[model samples]
Target chain A: MPAVSMPIAMSELIVRLQQESPIPMDAELRCTGGQLLALVGPSGSGKTTLLRALAGLVQPRHGYISCSGETWFDSAAGHYLPARKRRVGYVPQHFALFPHLDVLHNVMSGMLHRAPETRVAAAHDLLERVNLAGLESRKPGQLSGGQQQRVAVARALAREPQVLLLDEPFSAVDHATRERLYGELAMLKQSLSMPLVMVTHDLREAMLLADEMCVLHRGRTLQTDKPLELVARPVSADVARLVGIRNIYHGEIAGHAPEHECTQLRFGSIVLKTPYRPELVPGSRVQWVIPSDGVVFHRRDRPSHTERENQLQGIVDTVHKLGEITRLAVRMEDEDRSLLWLDVPSHLARRNEIAEGVTATVSLTVAAIHIIDSTS
Target chain B: MDWQALRLSLLLAVATTVLLLPVGVFAGRWMAESNFRGKILLEAAIATPLVLPPTVIGYYLLVGMGAHSPVGVWFTELFGRSLVFSFSGLLIASVLVNLPFAIQPAQRAFESIPQDVRDAAQCCGMTFWRSLWAIDLPLAWPGVLTGLTLSFAHTLGEFGVVLMVGGAIPGETKTVSIAIYDQVQSLNFEGAGSMSLLLLLISLGLLVFANVLGRYAGRLHAYRNV
Candidate 1:
């Protein structure tokens, strides 16, 4: 064992989210043990608001936030610890690096009042960890935007906070830098043992970094699950849309049978099979979820065995090229105005001879088709 | 040369700066951070002595501080004498007359600091005064120094106020400007010329000092903004 012992393991965070506003709802979130929880939502979705409430920056009109039995904020008892005492590492959207201080001083700033002696060493270690070695003498203005952001991260970590809250940390950087920083952040979280909660509108970033994903809308949590589960089984049409599920069908359960039967999903003359359960009564409203990647594009017709599963015919409305993937917006001739979006690799798109305003058949395996009852 | 006037002027300028520097710092800080009603009005009122003719200020001071007035009587009771026609009276007038110059620069320096920087400092567990002294003051030093120099320069040029209130008593109430006026009145061009040349040099030196100090502060602020 090393001579220096680790700080005591901190408590999990508990946030009872409520507000006295035009719209009202009760939300209770418990993150037990040390675990990364990603709050994913669109803009104006109240993720930042929740982060602020947890940090005691903004007092929620009601509810409380407790971490490991330590009270940070409790409206009932009037116990609201200031932001400094809460010991949270909050990296705001703008990074908020002190313009006056150089990289070294910015990191050491959080340490000035407490443990002033170890401030320099701690700052240096964190900077080195973030791969900003020997850049301490440079002021924030002198560094590149990405380098400045890394310095801000180092400063936040210098305090050795128990929990870290990051608000769109990489949204300001370019794609290449954003990816590099994300890789560094992944390594940091593994070594630091601090649970991180990051808010990002970027679906791919959230999918890559989050351990548990939360889908929020209008200040409410619609679904909270694993990243894979969030994509596989979205709770609502909104959640499905948020996670980039391009093929969402508004269908009615047409058939139900005994053990392992099938529920016939009818959208526009096009019907698909979902695992049959007794609860899936005929004429009941249901939503089917299929990710854009799950839908395959092809030129030549395949065998009926594969075609019987989850295939639909549509006209290619538009082809939008985005980096490595080409997004094809295909219009289904079905009566249900459901649009199927197929994401094909740029190479595959070039090889398949797909073009805008052309006829194409996109297919999704039945196993890839996920059905959810509207009553949920 | 009328040395008495030169000595009084020097004494008045230095004493006024020393007396009002603390108040100016506080007021400047308040103006930078605090939000209050009629702030513009208060600023204008403080600057009235700078904008209004010195003779008008001198007339008001004369009437307000004379031995017969209530305030003058109370002041006399406290200090065993009145302020009128005294060197100490000139000191009070200089502090009042040059207050805006002292406060304006300091306020500007303080105001130039970004609010986010202060918020970040507060989040790092610093109290208001702790951050102000450690962070804000160092950043605002150039402005404070500029304010000091301006106040000193303005007070050194005091004439109408001292003549109206201090009554030009040799070795007691007379300042450099009053002495120069006395020399001119008595047709002593050589004495007046010597005094005028000295004042000119002093004014130039202070102005140059202020310009350099202000430039340094501006650069620091610009770097921070970047």
Candidate 2:
């Protein structure tokens, strides 16, 4: 039989949007199968609301959700299954560990009713897997925050769920601990073979863990695609800004020169080349996305011939050291009044001694110049 | 000194706390989670018994339990019993009067729990019963304990309600508090002094015990929320 004939049924999720404004608004959507997807948005963006709705905790005015093809909620059908029957594992941001139960008891609680005696040993195995082996007998109050979160993760997995929802799981942990947990989670996802949905505000985390990233704004999914693609080629300026693209330029397409195989953008006296197909006639509004890392710093006179894509004369207005990288805020003379932030590696920054008030030539490769779909 | 009275008092107190445990837990959960209109009014009403004179409650109970009343007739037919001047009547009165002692502390404890904890439990697909058993009950036990101790001790010291309903029936409804009052009324100095001392000591011991339990429970909640 073909793989399609023996296809494993995927979870069907749907949500309807309708709410008074200010924060995440109402929206409707349906997703199938257990896809490792990341819901990335800023604070108050409604990522948490979507997670809760899927979990059956927040019942919208109207929506339907089916897990693994099992109909759990249908407002039209008047079918509603409580969270317990939904059988989804939800790991909250705080990882609510039972205070009265020890680590072993906490993990075992998931399987308590179905398999009573197996819980103790299963808990031990899970604890050991999460790197809390000997600490199973210890109460949650005795454990550190990271350890408690690990215990919470172990508990959620004990149920052997098909779908797992994580809400900002690493937000509370230190950088080193978060890295370690992320590695653990990746390993767990491989073995679980389940759709793991995560809500995150951190761009790095979304990029690292998400198979597909959904960018939500005011409760609507603005863009959904592979993680790297969202950053390298955003759907719009809002998405580019959300993904931390610090350089955005507004200009008009001056002309399309077939000989150059590029479109010429006119901003004041400077002309920049964009690799995007010239889709409009001359004098159409357009925006350019240049990531901070794409902007290279060099003395106005010293430059490479290979970097002949987009060059602009700008003064280094400010410079600040940020860990392993140096951040430079450059002011370009454009009618749009946009500021460009360029990130230089610490070693390169030190060698070049880039500082404020230094006149520098900002060069961007045509490949790095991403054309954003204009709102208008 | 009056063994029958002493036994009656102890019986009423223990019975009241035992009866109110489930009620206290239910009320605590309700008040903690529910956000309805008149919620504060309901809470104030529940705590009214604690502040109002016990005699006023006793007077209402006496009127309601009168042989001609509807409640009295229902009780008569259903249980083949009349409540006035009976030991069971005192037990019922004590449980009703001291309910707030148990419920108020339990509610406060349940309220102290973070919403994140409840949301976490809900997210795990744990049903209402399972969440209550596995999370809410355990987390709120310290508060329950506080309510239990207070209700029991308060019930033991009740004189007004027991006097009005149970009366001074020897070997049946003559609780220690009532007996002490009777002794003082009759000028039985020795009997009054001895019974009063015992009641005072027992109540003092219980208060001390509750203080220790409260401290230990505080530590437990702190430990778990970590």
Candidate 3:
């Protein structure tokens, strides 16, 4: 038997889930011990199915799920453990707390094999840990949504499971309450040494909570990387859009600067510089993304650099004010009328007097530009 | 008053209700949750008693339980007793006639429970039987209780099926409905009137109790979702 603290690894988790209309799915994921892997996708993207497969709830058509050297499922071996036999703490979307059991009993119900006294003590201790100490006697029906979710988490943990699976656990709660729950979960994550997989459609929540993120689309994993890495270097245009990178354009390699190790890309009549890729030959067509935050707007009175390497002079096509940030659509002075999106702080937008029809000089930071092969 | 008839009827009703509790729950759950070929056919068969006239059911029971039939002959050889025109025969008739009443509402109750609750129970290391006891039964109790009460009440008022299968043996199979019919035929107006009033009150009371329980079940279901 492997120690409880070791990571749970699942390889080639191939499942064909039948829905009202069939959606293809082939998902693979990995989580190190004590790390949180957030599985994010749009609805019907097989995020929940993957979580269920890991918990031994959904039997995949082909796969092997192993944790600490224990085989939970293997197609070749014809070995599959049922959900009850798999030591997984699952917090479903609705929390699924037993309506008949009081909070303490709900937690204790998972510890059925423990001694009575020990179960009681541990249940109480867990309730306190979830900030639900005095509500132990309350039924799930009487508690608030957040409180009920807390009870669910505590109950799942009471099982002393080897892995924890949460499916949109915070989606039901109000935003204010969700923030607090996020704080509680972050603290809880520090103490738990088992692998945890959370399924969420909320990109912000996944970015905020997950140590690593696996972006799923149409039942397949597009990319798996640290949140920052995923946002910074999405593998494809679809992945770039999913990660909130809104500024993408078609460009071909114009030339290479060997001294600076950078490639110049021509987008219509405009040219830009990005880090060089060895795979790229001159004239190779590719898609490039510039993070919206990387497009900087210079003050109207500031002295403009005469160098035209990374700078573009364009007329602001539209302006949208969204609380703290202002989003602008800038149409480049090119034949294709290519538009670039830039997000500027509202304060900066006000100082620069940026608006629709205003000519603005925006610079795309070369270090922030990323390119992907068009074929991928 | 035909006290023997009343006693036998009550006994038959109680026994049928008790016997059908586990069967109803198990069948209800299976019907609600499982999907396989021929499920619709099985459901239609279970519901046949609800749509068919009581005499149709009584006629089948009578034929099936007669000593000439294979099942009846086997029972006679094994137990050394006839199944037809006996208290046991009436019990079987009542169970068949009231099965739909018990199963329909129970199936609805089981179906109403969210699937997530069942999944959560299994993920908590609960076996099928344990989840039924700890979660399904308690969450669906009011509806199940309503089913049981409806079955009991329907059995108490049983007439055609009991009359055909049990044939009005005074101390054995004669039930309240048959006794009242006998009294009315003999022009004993007062006796018939009293028995009629008693039956009316019991049926009315059970119906009211079931209604109250159904309302409570609705409230509980709403609470669970909250």
lDDT of 1 by residue, A1-376 (tens): 1111212236577777677584443555656555778888888888887776666566777777777667777777777787777767777776777776788988887775557687888888888888899999998879876897888778777766767778888987888989898888887778766667888898888889888888878888888899998898888889998887878887877776444466677776766776555676788777788887677777554524473367677788888889899989898877754578878888777777778877788777666677876776
Can you give the lDDT of residue A307 in candidate 3? 33
User: For each candidate, what is the lDDT?
Assistant: 0.79, 0.79, 0.85
10 residues in a row with least lDDT, candidate 2 chain A: A1-10
Name the DockQ score for candidate 3: 0.77
Per-candidate DockQ values are 0.38, 0.57, 0.77
Instruction: Rate residue A162 of model 3 by lDDT.
Output: 78
User: Which tens-of-lDDT digit does each residue in B82-142 have in candidate 2?
Assistant: 8778877777888888878889889988887777678767655567888888899888887
Query: For candidate 3, lDDT tens digit of each residue in A299-375?
Result: 88993553333888999999999999999999987677878898888998999888789999988888788888755
lDDT of 2 by residue, A1-376 (tens): 1122223455544445444543445554444445678888898889998887777776655555666766666667778777666677788888877777788878887774456767777878888888899997888778877898888888888877657889899987888989988888888777666677899999899888878888888787888888988888888888888888878777777888777778777766677777746674578777778888777777534675463557776777888999998888887877654577988887777777677877667777777777665653
Q: Write the per-residue lDDT of candidate 3 for residues B2-105, one digit (tens) a residue.
A: 88889888988899999889878988888899989998898899889988988888899999989999989998999899999988878877887787888889
Each candidate's clash count = 3, 5, 0
Model 3: residues >4 Å from true position, as ranges?
A1-23, A303-309, A347-353, A374-376
Give the Cα RMSD of candidate 1: 5.4
Best by lDDT: 3
| Candidate with best DockQ | 3
**Preferred candidate (DockQ higher): 2 or 3:** 3
In TM-score terms, candidate 1 sits at 0.82
